[model samples]
Target: MQHALTKVGPDYDVVVLGAGAGGMSAAIFAAMEGARVLLVERTEYLGGTTSYSAATTWIPLTRHAQAMGADDSRDKVSGFLDRAVGNHSSKSVRDAFVAAGTGVVDALEDKTDVKFRARPFHPDYLYELEGATSFGRALEPLPFDASALGKDLHLIRPPIPEFTILGGLMVDRDDIAHLMRIGKSAKSTAYSARLIGHYYLDKIRQGRGTRLVMGNALIGRMLLAARKLGVTILTETEALAFTTGPDGVTGVTLRQKDTERQIHVTGGLILASGGFARHPTMRADKLPQPLPEFSPSAPGHTGTLHDLAFTAGAYHGDTAAQPCFWAPVSHRKRADGSMAVFPHFVFDRSKPGIISVGRDGRRFVNESTSYHLFVSAMYAANKDGSHVPTYLIADAAALKKYGMGMIRPGGANIAPYLADGYLTEAATLDELAGKLGIDAAGLNDSVARMNAYARSGTDADFARGTTVYEKANGDPTHGPNPTLGPLETAPYYAVKLWPGDIGSAIGLVGDENAQLLRRDGSAIPGLYACGNDLQSIMGGVYPGPGITVGPAIVFGAIAARHAARRAVAARKGDAA
Candidate 1:
């Protein structure tokens, strides 16, 4: 098998910008296919949001699910995705993803040490949504010793408290429960303990814990594989813009802390620098309603490619789809009067919990909806001029059942929320409303209506008491229905939540072959884009788990292959 040849100079076969999951994967895959590659990134670390994300699941209908007896296929996956964006995803992009999906998976499994398995418990965001498949499509990385990465792990982002690296990969809530269950059985407990011990040893040796890499693991494994193949990663270097000659992209101008150098890399340029998640101007112009929320991504995601690509006469589209939908969060005014906030607590209201109101307090939508749906609703609700942030009202019983108060159950991140009255507490509803600046009358009315729903086991107003899964996931302490609880109990607590986004979606437009497009619907010669830097083929909504990572890996590899092919073809044509 011919791998990408690495010959460092002003020219090569490919120059992949950004060391994010997609960029890294694209660089490695392209190199593996015999293209000399240069992986450039802005941050000191390699994982963009991949290293520091709550990526707990992978999506798609995959071999794992089929082996596990899940009836999933490429056709179903394609149909499901088609329904997601109202079938607007270009046939070319969809076809390319489908055709390359298996190859990408097989390449990683056979060529790299990234171990993965088909997990049974993970589910689609909407299991009932049309064309949705249950399991097998999403393959999760078996937890591996981060220690293998040595000092490289230190530069990588830590796991978000929302997730845990139990063995060497990311694990979800169901996995945690299974671990506990196994611990209860004598035979299972002993076996499980050994596995756990191995994970602990890996972490101890490597200075990190074992984890399940839902999507993040996929990226992690790919990067490790790429690094093993000798992909040259230049960190802390920002690609300012494309260096264009009379022909096209000639090289890249990079900034290295008070020093500007124009490195003329001859290989095809792959702009995967990520979308403008941090660009104030783009956020203001594109997402007018939600206002750009705080992104955990690095500061370098300023859409350099967008500006440079436009200047180079590249075509970009789908800038209107809000990629990262912010979850509910709250901010606190520090001593300096400035505020620092985070994606606040989204108490799973599928169970009997209270959706707190504002000064005019009201229950807006079904709280059980995913963060994306909730944020979209918030944008729609407040678009008419309501900016008051809402609170998620939880009773002490409910809080205890789901560990709702902590920043990730046991994490210490939200102690400040409890300390500064940001998390309001009261023993009574009326008193709570008074404390939270809500009109007592409005509060009483909403609660009465909600309580009535609780009694009848039906949410007449907003259908809060809707899905069985929602009720099953609700607080068990709440009688009969889990989601229709009236927070009329003592020791009631309220956490303020504002809309927050995961990251900006919608980026560079590319053809099915992963070639970046020109404004006139032509390909940008040898350029490609993937991940958040490329317009999300998902059309704004996260169709399933790993929506970002799946395409990222699939197309990152495709971009590399196509670029190498382009190089090969160019060489052949020149000879001819």
Candidate 2:
């Protein structure tokens, strides 16, 4: 039965705020253990970054990857994570995270109806990096029927249209191969062709012709699970404050439907309200580079719960926000007023003629590195009189093939630089500089040096020629290297690329049990934080696939299990 709008000291065993991937998993798992759970989200939608991220694949060294022979182990993964984030991470937190990660992911996959399978071929950031493993580690949710979610389907952001099938024909690996064999093996190809044709026809007849998958697919599955479990999803609902006492957290105060009310969750409260990314002032103050490209993350990640938790005497750690980890993209708006993420620059490596420069019109780090590294370099460059408005220079061919070479074609709102004519395009390098109001001569020198390196298949300044995948991803057509290309072509294009963050790396510091800790390294009773809200159990650097979601679910399960045990003890004491 539906409960009334009346405000009671509503009590639940567990209350999870934010229905993102982490929150959803936590809610569902907690419910399975007989906890009366309440899940609160600011948006009507369920999926968070998982819904918008290109991180379609999970990280390597995960349990999902190991079953597929990726040679990843908890110890190796732990080592890599420690090396990446350094000593700031507590041993307790790390050990607990590693201990529970595999069990959590496996539990979600097997216990819940979530349709996820290992995407065996997905590559790690650096295939050669220590603790880095090949295929079998990164898991992606297989596409759902969509007809299952029905109305709740719209709650998720749609996949970009262009990535869908060509000519309304859904083509898989077998279908594509069969089409190629059409002329040679008429009989054999005919069977495969008929199978493919029937597949598309059925999808079309069911109005499911335009199928989009990847990370969005995973999110859809999670939402379905959450919905089936009867999770109370309140979008546009904000938790304003916390109700706590000397024992621990009593409950939470939420402002919903323009009315403020307090709900008492007796079991536990989970703060999955995400980090502060859209808050311009907070981001500018915390992150190295203020302005970011398309944050595939939802807009409501303002660290509200973080503030509330601290005010309620809860401790937090790792407040330095982590910028978006993917490549930069410039979105172009469609007629429907929707935007598409253009991933050409990151995916298309043939255009080595392009270079990313800082505000000082100087070449910094390799433009093709991870967006995290790119932002770090931007921050470093800022110390040397580098300005905010940077430029991404490309010749005519690169522009034509890549379409201003954004992560997506559809335009989305980026800050500061977008307002200051940061995206300047021109036919000649001089004209481009004139448009950008920079030193025309300095621009030319940078271009000449870059082109020289491109021709010689060597990057003396930055050592860009070292990686095989880099050459494969950056240099598509050229022999030996794709990152090195001559920029002498006419009609150049320059679109500004900025480093935006997915969420902050900083949050509540917790022990191995995922228990919230005080500044003096003491545990706060009955309080815990995970996902982006925790002081990043991985320290600061992202490790393995599902780095964000993996620990989130793991710690959530850990917290829920601990909370359940505590409840049982409390109930026995009360009876006694």
Candidate 3:
């Protein structure tokens, strides 16, 4: 249902720039606080890169933890973060995030449509750390009925094409097993029928399915909630500059297509623009040498707002370990001429019968480790130029059962993949190594060593299946070890992998209240930042799943709630 735009004054009370998870949540919180807000996006779609993601948030000490009996605590999380992050980021902001996690989550659950469910066994990435829990810190969005948005459903960014299947069916990773068994069992067959029927019906009506899951569901809920509160939403709008006055950033100058307008604000100016991951200048200045050419993230975070933001005395946080978070990506051109940068995030590497090898055809890092760690290993291994573009080796059976990069499971067409040169196929190990231009003898030796390891049920080289997190991603039914298996299946397959920076780890430094700060540590009044615009709380260390989104939502709430309170206080003073 559409309502007339709510307004506290002539123009607006607050203006939220950027429509990612953080910015969207900020607008909703401001609106709930009785402030008329305008949510703006430079692109036509609202979800940003998050809609292309799994939409998990790593927030500790919530009721979800209690419900799952996760045995997690604030102190445990704090200790782990301290050990993992050290002084890479501001401790004050980190502590603030912990203190407000439960409150923000509870409020969203009780007062808004946004909802989350705990995964009982999704362990933190750094599971070896003392403060790490086996489960419950990570919360995922529940599936959403996108038809609730009616015609506005398209306003949300669609999922990445590579993440979907059968034209546009967005199936969960767990549900994929049931889909593969369509006719094998009665229950699976019925489930597959309903899912396929629902997708086709939705496609017939809206040109795309509306059963939103993962990050899209989360974005949809926020969009619907923002609309329910009469928040004005504008897409294809760009923020030019900030308008300042005695009350600080009083408003923003914006341009929509051909039109230009300056709207003064009575409340706050929130900057949640994704981040500088794609900015050429930032990439050169912040990232390491031999710069990456591909990113799996959405194209919105080009650091477009940073230059304008610097004019207001805001500067980048200087203490991060690296400028951006990482993942080893494999890219291929699609039939539509679009490039698909597939992130190898625990599908094939962690599974049995696959191993990542450098140019010398030797194992480099634990193939089953987290994506961030995998890329970091790539960077480390490439120092001597041996592994910049590593090759992931898997047998034909493994490729069919688990699927390589850019190829989904359920026996997808390997012929097309081979025809496109995205996947290299050969009948023998020596021939496979010859095609990849790697050492064939070394490849033979590596496979023989792997076969011995499989028989012994141990990864003597990198201990691939040692950790709980790695095992969680591995095949549980496999005998001996879940992640340890011989590459004995004939006809090997290979895909080239490159280091891909997924998102920026650095952003404008802010306080616990999510207010942007000057160099001297004083606050930039009425100027706030969240999402990637705000410096990550973990300080660039990949601690676990949902690290980016966890603090994003928490601080977005802090910024909006604080600004709303300030607006109310100012109104009271004027009345007095």
Instruction: Please provide TM-scores, in order, for all candidate models, with all chains considered together.
Output: 0.85, 0.82, 0.97
TM-score of 2: 0.82
Q: Write the per-residue lDDT of candidate 2 for residues 1-576, one digit (tens) a residue.
A: 112225334667777887666677677877777676777777666667666654343434456665676776778766766666566567667777776766776777777766556754554545446765545656666655566766566676544454444433434334545665677898757866676665577566554432335556666677777667766566667888888788788778887676777887766777776665555565666555445546545666787677777776666565333533433444555457766444433543334777777655668877656555555666667675464445778776665544344322222332332344444557788888887776777788888898888778888877774554355456456744677777876877677655446656767777776667778877766676666777776555554445677677677777776665665666678799
Total clashes, candidate 2? 39
Regions of model 2 farther than 4 Å from truth: 1-9, 55-63, 126-129, 157-212, 258-260, 278-285, 289-296, 318-345, 348-351, 384-387, 406-424, 468-472, 475-477, 542-546
What TM-score does structure 1 among the candidates reach?
Answer: 0.85
Which candidate should be chosen as best, given TM-score against the real structure?
A: 3
Candidate 1 stretches with Cα past 4 Å from truth are 1-8, 56-59, 161-216, 245-247, 258-261, 265-267, 319-323, 331-349, 356-358, 405-416, 465-488, 573-576
Rank by lDDT (best first): 3, 1, 2
For model 2, where is the 10-residue window of minimal lDDT?
Answer: 407-416
In candidate 1, clashing pairs total 42
What is the lDDT of every predicted structure here? 0.66, 0.63, 0.86
Q: How do the residues 1-576 of candidate 1 rate in per-residue lDDT, one tens digit apiece?
A: 112122235566788887776787788888788777778777766677766554433545445565689877778877777776654457568767877877677777788876668756545655556767655666666655454565656556555443444424445554555565684778657756765777677566766654435445555666677778877667767777777776467678767566666666544788777677677677677765546455444455777677888777775565435556456656566566755545542345454645656556776777766667666777677754453466777766555445443333332354576788777767777788888877668767877787777788787876664543344446556676766665555677777767766665677888887777887887776667888778777778766656776787788888888887877777788699
Cα distance off (Å), candidate 3, residue 270? 1.0
